[model samples]
Target: MKAVAIQSFGSPSGLAVIDLPVPAPADGQVLIATEAIGVGGVDVLIRSGALADYGFAEGHIPGSEVAGTVTAVGDGVDTSWIGRRVWAFTGVGGGYVEQAVAPVDEVLPLPAGLSAVDAVTLGSSGVVAHFALAHAHFAPGESVLVRGAAGSIGVTTVQLAARGGAGAVAVTTSSAERGDRLRKLGATHVLDRSGEGDADAPPGYDVIVDIVAGADLPSFFARLNPNGRMVAVGMVGGPPPADFGMTMMAAFRKSMSFATFSADTVPVSDRRAVRAGQFAAAGRGELEMVVHELLPLDQAVSAHRKMDAGEVFGRIVLTP
Candidate 1:
């Protein structure tokens, strides 16, 4: 099997494609012929050696989201899953290869109406979006803000929020062009990150999905309604502000609580449920997984380059 591995952690160029022996599934696991692998920002961070503490070491096969067909099953696993099309979160690595093995319990059947490409792109992002919306405890007619609303997770979050009955979904995009795309994804209003649109923006939103954490923290918190919740998902903007203390103090006064979605912390059963629900939503046309581009497995380096440049509007997927 051919796999993309980080030979060194520095640049996208550091990722090298090499042939490796195919891995066999262990007991309770199943081997999948990977049809699509989803690229993520965490892959970029790992490739760049920025997330070393997260245990992404050199030579690590770096991908978690995959969609494929079950080719074989290991001992103690049900044979029924063989030949079934599925999508899953690998939890660690092995997604960037022609063949990967995953615990049978972690895999979910792809909905009838979803494609492998869309399923892979929705991998973890869609699961997190679903979990985030659930955590917000939103009700019909509530308004919400989605930061980084044009990116993969942002796009899914917008769709899920709207489908869950948000009356108004305000999405923040760094560029006017991206804002237009967000609007098409169901955002009732798209706010430019340039601060020009801040004057007349709604004072308080029922929930704020903060994907771009750093600088946007202040403005995001300020826009939250009393007792509102903020789910921090990404740090695209930069590191959290040094004055996070003050920000938390403000949130404290307003009775607002901050929440974060950590895939590692989510129980396997819960994660599986969320992934299944997301796929069902996609099948029903109530949620969408935006696929910005699809590249062959050999172009994995180029895919990482595009992501690092912030040039992709949605998920970049690689087909094996």
Candidate 2:
């Protein structure tokens, strides 16, 4: 098996590919022949040791999303799954290789008519988007806003919100090019975060799906309607604001709720259901999980570099 491993914590340049023994499935586990591996923001964080303070160790394989075929099954696993096409959220690592071993319970069948690449593109981003929107409980005909709406998760959220019957979907993007893409993805309005404009709403929005959290959060909070919900899924813009006093006070006064979508904490069953929904939406042409680029397995470092530079507009897959 060939896998990308981070022997040291630094930049994407530190990632190296090496030959390793293919892992065998333990009891209740299944081994998958990897076809596609999804590169994610969290993987870059793990590779650079940004997550080391949280106990993520170095020298670990740096992938979590996988889509492939089942090649072998361990004791207690159903033999019927041996030849099935599936996708899984590998909790730790080892997906960026020729093969991956995961608990049978963690893998889900790929929806009919969906390719491995499409399934892999959904990955954790789609699951988190589904969870966030479903948890927010936005009513049909209500207005919603999504920060970083041109990113993978943001695009997924935009499609889901539209499918759920949102009256209007406002998305924020830094560039005019991405703003156009977001509008095509179902955003009723696109706001340029870099430009001077009234980001604050008149009455406020029904929900705010914020992937960028920083000092700008106070301004985002001002756009929330009474009882509006803000779901934080990413912090691409940087850390939370130093002075969130007004934001916190306003949220409390307006009965607003704050939530975070961490796919690691979501139940496997719920994750599978979300994937199913994403696939259905894709089939209906209502959702598009764009793949900005595809690179061979050995080019993992370059893929990470592109992600780190913020050059990828959608998910980047590693073909093994």
Q: Which candidate achieves the best TM-score against the true structure?
A: 1
The top-ranked prediction according to lDDT is 1
Q: Give lDDT tens digits, candidate 1, residues 127-207.
A: 778778777787789988888777788888998888888988898887878877788888878787633365556767888
TM match of model 1 to true structure: 0.93
- Screening candidate 2 with a backbone cut-off below 3 angstroms (N, C-alpha, C), the clashing residue pairs are none
List model 2 lDDT by residue over 71-153, tens digit each: 99999999999999998777767788899998888898887777888888876788888888877887898888988776678
The CA lDDT at 109 in model 2 is 85
lDDT of each: 0.83, 0.82
RMSD of each: 1.9, 2.2
TM-score of each: 0.93, 0.92
Cand. 1 Cα-lDDT: 0.83
